[model samples]
Target: MPFQHPETTGHGYVIERYVTRKDSDHPRYLELNGAHVLRPGWPHAKRFARHLIDDATTITDAELEALLAYEWRSRLTAAWLIGVDRRESFRERIGDLLLASEVCYSGGGFCFALARFGTHADAEILTAYLDHYLPRTDLHYDQPDALGALLHLDARLGTHHADRITEPDGLWDEWVKGVGRLGHPSHTPAELRRWTDLHCDFINDWSRS
Candidate 1:
């Protein structure tokens, strides 16, 4: 089933499941400048991110944007993999995607990913979603990811988000340093705010009730 953004009448993406093992976590070649040389159909999203991080300085913006269409995970992965080097491309291209998406897991992922990977300008991009959901009654049921995105963005960009976030302090504290266990801070789910390694005081009370 293809799910779309509620706000967008006909905009959405599909999560493709890989049937066979093909792409490897390690790239075929690693450049001296941390640039990862990737072939056309590499399967692993982590490998792609590793490549991006490795080649943060050398990879071209066009090359990074091109990877956005590679797969679902990679698309989001690419958003975070994008470093401060070619921020304009990420702001332009990824910003377009984020603005087009409605409030959902994918949106939150994009929200968190970009906010974490993005720079000062990203604060503007993230607050819209954060403020949008923070006021909703359903926030108790959903929106930890969005909240976390704000915290991550604030922490990273030094933006004063503490005033904007009206949610309980306990909820905000759930977002710890180092992006939690959901991989990079950008990769964390918009709905989940707990850490896998550390003991946290968060449970989906809405679900339990």
Candidate 2:
């Protein structure tokens, strides 16, 4: 039996189950970004966006924001997947996708999604995030996803916006140190090693929660 979240529609298994199942029987689905799962199989991105907006009641404000951010990430991933398959439709969506990518919050998930897209627009969004969010002491910087996104965005976008990234204070340094281990395609081996060491600790803490 599939485990279910109360929040799930129960029309099918939740995304976690869907993704794990995709790894085996449905490799093509694997290529579909987890972010895209926000819309499932919708033919049009705008339709997908509408679905999300309609389903807004099912999720909290933070989760809705995360999903919006994830949706943009998924669009980029979909573009890449379509490009790999030589699909002409992918080209048509690129501009719209770039615009959608800007809707996400400046967290690691958002950043990772941007890095995955790796477009000029993605770089601009990442730069804007660093400028608007990092300077605020009231905002939490401890989330690994946010740090990972920043690190990956930095690696992909380079030092063009480096001056904007303030030094990590509070748990920000620890957060970056943790994400360094996850070893995204965007990171160097040295960066990966450092991140992995920190990430392991982070994971251990997360497991306890």
Candidate 3:
């Protein structure tokens, strides 16, 4: 299902305003314009990752949903909170956003949240995104992270949903061919690991502290 933005008129607009304002002080709020926490700059968001986890636990679902309707920053923040809280209800909506690829940067959050959900339904959603987007060789959205999420899901659920995608001369082939033209590597295991760990760090590492 496509993600429908609530009519941004009276109350909807207020919701948007509320979330946007709420996301302002997030540690990596400014980084929402580009790739999220797992970019080249190691530890950029690490010091404050725990604080965000603390915030995620307390934020209400209504606010998180409203944040999803706002800018990438708000959407990313909402995704993290939803994941930390394990709010599985938002899985479909986050998958919708991943497929829409409507905005930049937020796809990481969407993918991460779906992975954290760790269910077959979540895997299906990730598969759906790959089915639709991977063939579009000219585009570079969240395909890598989506693939990584599927991999994680497969490992958790004991399913091979991502096998064909990562298979030889398959959709993964198309993705590599497309990204190669742009001088980017065909695979980014390090980035994928970082993305996967970012969520784990929030859930485990922070809890220990």
Candidate 4:
């Protein structure tokens, strides 16, 4: 029998289970640049991240392209791998995918990759994403992740690229209200940290409960 795409099953656990595999950690890639600390599955996530970064030279561009062509999980993993490796040649391709926003879940990976690139061009791509999507409050697609990426870039580059969107009553504010209506309002530091790392707190709480 042939392997099936996890998303096709329409079962979230099936998808989450797929996350533990070596090649793809969709939705979260274990922040390569994150501050080192302990958390649930931190050892597991960190190990995979280190492996990807360590073996970056061995991963061929052809392999990454194939990953990008597959489902969101593969695309997510590809983005992190590309970013960590500093594969400048793939930057445009990643940026295009980020702008397309064709699929769900993988956008976070794209954002992380672009942020890793840490170039003004990468920041522009992130800005363009927020410009186009933040106003579409009903869609709720990766706006926060893009914004987070932009802010991360700004801090690194000493640029204020994210200032306009974050102002009171600006696009970010509008998005917050919309998200709040759906009971998903928080974007605090702790909440934002989950975007980069495995949600260890969530996992611990879930397992205990």
**Model 3 Cα shift for residue 111 (angstroms):** 0.3
Q: Write the per-residue lDDT of candidate 3 for residues 125-166, one digit (tens) a residue.
A: 989998998888888888888888888778778999988987
Summarize candidate 2's per-residue lDDT along 45-142 as a digit string, tens digits.
Answer: 34333332233224333332222224333333333333222333233233333333343332333333444454555556545544554444344432
Write model 1 residue lDDT over 1-209, tens digit each, in one string.
24332224321221211111123433222221122322233344345334334554554555455545444444544454453233555666665566555323334435545544546666666666555544443333124545555555565566776443544443233433223443433333333322211101111111122
Each candidate structure's count of clashing pairs: 5, 8, 0, 0
Ranking by lDDT: 3, 4, 1, 2
lDDT on C-alpha atoms for all candidate structures: 0.41, 0.36, 0.72, 0.65
Please give each candidate's TM-score: 0.45, 0.34, 0.78, 0.72
Give stretches of model 3 more than 4 Å off.
1-26, 31-47, 188-194
Most lDDT-accurate candidate = 3
| Total colliding residue pairs, candidate 3 | 0
lDDT of 2: 0.36
lDDT of 3 at 207: 62
Using lDDT as the measure, name the better of candidate 1 and candidate 3: 3
Off by over 4 Å in 1: 1-52, 55-58, 69-71, 83-86, 102-109, 133-142, 156-158, 168-209
Residue 39 in model 4: shift from native, Å? Answer: 2.3
Residue pairs of candidate 2 with colliding backbone atoms: 108-145, 108-146, 178-198, 178-199, 180-195, 180-196, 181-195, 181-196
Ranking by TM-score: 3, 4, 1, 2
Candidate 4 ranges beyond 4 A from true positions:
1-20, 23-41, 188-209
